[model samples]
Target: MDGYTTALVCAAAAAGAALVRSGKRYIDNSAVELLAAPDGVRAMIEAHCPSLVAPARARLVPPPYLPTGMLQTIYGAMVALRRDSESDIEYDRQLRTMEDGGTVSLDWFPARPSGPECAQPIAIVMSGLGGSAYEYHIRCLAKHLATKSRAGMRVAVLNYRGSGRTPLTSSTMYNGYDTSDIYDTVGYLAQSFPRAPLVCVGFSMGANLLARYLGETGDKSRIAACVTVSCPFSGETAGRAINAPGLLFDKFFQPALTGTIKRIVKRNQDIIQSGAITYDIDAIMRAKRVCDVDNALTARAYGFKDCWEYYAACSSTDFIERIRCPFLAINALDDPIALPEGLPMDQIAKNPRAAIALVAHGGHIGFFSGLSARMWHLQPVLEFLDAVLADKAE
Candidate 1:
């Protein structure tokens, strides 16, 4: 089947899955509907994470024009764009130079005064595509996890090279395919806090990267547990879904993403001009779609023959089954960007170490619920992390 047809089938299947559940709500007023197979992971979640089993119901008020999945996805992004940063949350920046001379910024949120220090649980936050510490979701997750009354966890945000105002020292820039930077960062965290039970939470593109990292590292992974939100499991399906005609989801996202890519390029234009990174600079700057930029730049930079090759090779779908660490993937079936067709449901079900929470509606990273329109996904995340930490402690 063609890409578009495949995406439609996936969407239909997701819709069918949502309806097949027993007519029961876990919690009053909760819009979240969990679709997970019966497994040890699910049992752990049920036993430890009570909030997820019976979360308080919250209302989602989507604007008039933003009704369907396509528009809801855009609306989700718009919400993130409009949110103001938390004033009370601050960071202590630590710049670490990678082996290749590229630099990544690890923004560590201040330690909790009331929380344990000697063996405090550590949570790392990874940003989405073109994301930084400035992104609302990243800040929200970091702050939420670090709350003394809540998780009381030590939190850090990993900003890729050239992101979070980190200078790009090497010719190579960051891409979803390469997990070396994450490998380096994780190594640093493991070494610095040897006794801490390390956990990671990644959103969108970062989620995909985290999944790939977990799968690749397998049993060697130092991370005790992980949660990925809105990950694009199959890049091929996701690319096709976003670029699908008539949906206009691509029309909304492509230009915006390309703009971000262009700005990043321009910031490190000197490195590109040095003839080190072999790509058509003008073509990249003129990219009208996300695919265009990927074809012109990302695919080449990563040594892939083309973007399609890169998409297939880098997609986390192939790696999900190999993941050894306890992992949870949180997704919205209606997310226009991360199409449900790509979710490795079969693989996840087979992997005893993995579980998935497929909500009927959460839009990419925008799981906004409640009358106040706050991020509702944070609750499940906190519950999951808290559960993992507790299980480890015992």
Candidate 2:
């Protein structure tokens, strides 16, 4: 079959599989509940997904509108195909040099209503694995925040070491647990806008980095609030889930990761020939699974013994309780990559400052809700950040 025909067949197969497995149960919402919020805000959320709220706490009686688990998961990936590239959203690119001599790219989109003269709050967005400011979800959220004139929130996205157009200066690539880059980026932002409140919004792997950084820094962290969307709390479990049979998460991720690794190797081929860096370029290029890519490329680059060790060390679940800042974790029960089962819900419940919104439908970072593929999690996130900032002010 031709490439277009192959893509069509794959999409059809995914839709067929979703339909066949429509009734297959996934999330058990009996114990799962929304984070404690004011009755009014709780009512708003419950109006959309009643399953998210406890039966006794729900004020609105709207029927839950969550799509089937399989549909949610499939649409999460499918929406990417239909998404428009937000190329028109302007940004001022800045290269923040890291301590390790490497550099990360930061794209700053100033708020439409507030310019440099105003002390506007900055939202530092960390994109998912191999994602840049150009990715659909990242750009969508950035654009949404930009259009919110009253919010006075500037969007700055941190493109990890090797991703985007940023060249990989160092031999090491970013791992899930590493937060040094974020720390430096936040520090830079703080210096640039000393009075501006720093609110971090991280998606997927970026979420893991933010969570780990918060836990590691505690009260010492400069940021005012944090929101982790679709973070894989337990990397070990998430890795296993992505590798599961018939799941398309690995298929979607592996190619991009492999391509990045290939480019990195090619860029540093001179060092490899000189025996300065030891990387099995052939094995890395041949990697088929996410696990293999992590083991051969990520683990080796980051000084981890193996992929399992890397996953265990990088897992944010271990650091959840250590987080003392006001934090919100939003995870979809149907997320195919970040399995809901791996979330540290118990830890979150114990921390008074930490809250969780366990939505029944958003798959990974895919929370497309309407005909135009509007992100379902955007408003809730904005509301949560507003609440956090208001509490801080008071």
Candidate 3:
């Protein structure tokens, strides 16, 4: 073919591919129609993600604490998802004595091997900031989802470096987490379960990591697909949004991180007494805030200049268009953590390789829609993952 003809064909293909990558579901108010909650839940979520309270038949769900059929079972897990204790705290444990810089032990759910003929895909779950494998009802969801299908999936929860056993090799972590860790873990799993399909899901902080992985890695991904729930694509906007005064976010999260870090620091009094580092443990915790935490910690602990440099280097916004795999990112405008400014839903919708699922609610890592405030943890999350993976075979 002539150069002109060849160029035209290439343009057409490119346009078509872009179209395929566009928004997963037609957004706007219609998206929130699926949430099942009281008027208060809608209002709460809307306060964070306004688009989360759309007019879906989803409201038909029964209220929490009430006894219903299968829905009750799911609600039980939701309650569990919301509950927390000292163990769930991220950075508060006493750490001066612990050798691993107060890092928690690594935790993971067991996975059954996925032999051939099984369409059921295994799901790898990534938890949010200061969150453990137990924090967000993930355990409940994993257990519950396993019961539904024939060849049940293996649900593996990713505890960030310091959150669990994988303590920080560095002092503090960054906003855009180390995607390489997740990629490596998933790679290890794929090799172990060659016949089984693998799917990945992340929430809030975890979601950002997943999105980064999607955008950064070229089209040749080993995992089947990914779901990013409540992730902020643009670091600056999200940082600004969460940092905004009067939202109660800093108040809600800072103490959690501070408290955790203090506990760890106190535990390792010997390390402090010996002057392993210049600053005291409490001083380190005091330096952390929603916006400043990543920088404060990284600089003091891991030795980065500031958070901006770290965010710029790690943020996934630059990698969006290069992703070749099929993935779905769920967002809610009302979510306090992930705002919709430079989120670029239009760009996502235009890309055929993506399924940009947007909602108006499910605050940060708190997407309990269609779930009750009872039970142990979030149950339906596994179902959502299951449904998404099952679709892959069809």
Q: Which one is best on TM-score?
A: 1
* Local accuracy by lDDT, each model: 0.77, 0.71, 0.53
RMSD of each: 9.6, 9.4, 16.8
- Candidate 3 is scored at a TM of 0.65
Clashes (N, CA, C under 3 Å) per candidate: 2, 0, 53
lDDT tens digits by residue: candidate 2, 212-248 = 9999888798888788999999989887877665644
The numbered model that scores best in lDDT is 1
User: Can you tell me which runs of candidate 2 are displaced by over 4 Å?
Assistant: 1-32, 36-88, 111-118, 247-251, 271-277
Better of 1 and 2 by TM-score: 1
Model 1 lDDT per residue over 1-394, tens place? 9999999999999888776552233222235455455765878877766555655432233333443455556666665545464424678888899997889988887742233334888888898888887677777877788873144688888998887788888877778789999999889777766777889999888999999999999999999899999999999988887666553644577777788889889888778656456678899998787778888888988778877888887799989889987788888787887988889999888887788876665678877654455676777788888887887888
For candidate 3, lDDT tens digit of each residue in 1-394? Answer: 9999999999999998877664222222224333222332223233322232335422223233332322332333345445454123222122211333433332434444435444446777776665667654555545555555444765667666556545454443423556666666667667766777877777767877887777766666777766676677777676666556653445654665556555554554455445344544455556656445555444444355776656555566666666665555665555565666756565554555554544444445544333333321233344345444555656
Off by over 4 Å in 1: 1-31, 35-37, 55-67, 81-88, 111-117, 148-151, 273-277
Residue 327 in candidate 1 has what lDDT?
A: 89
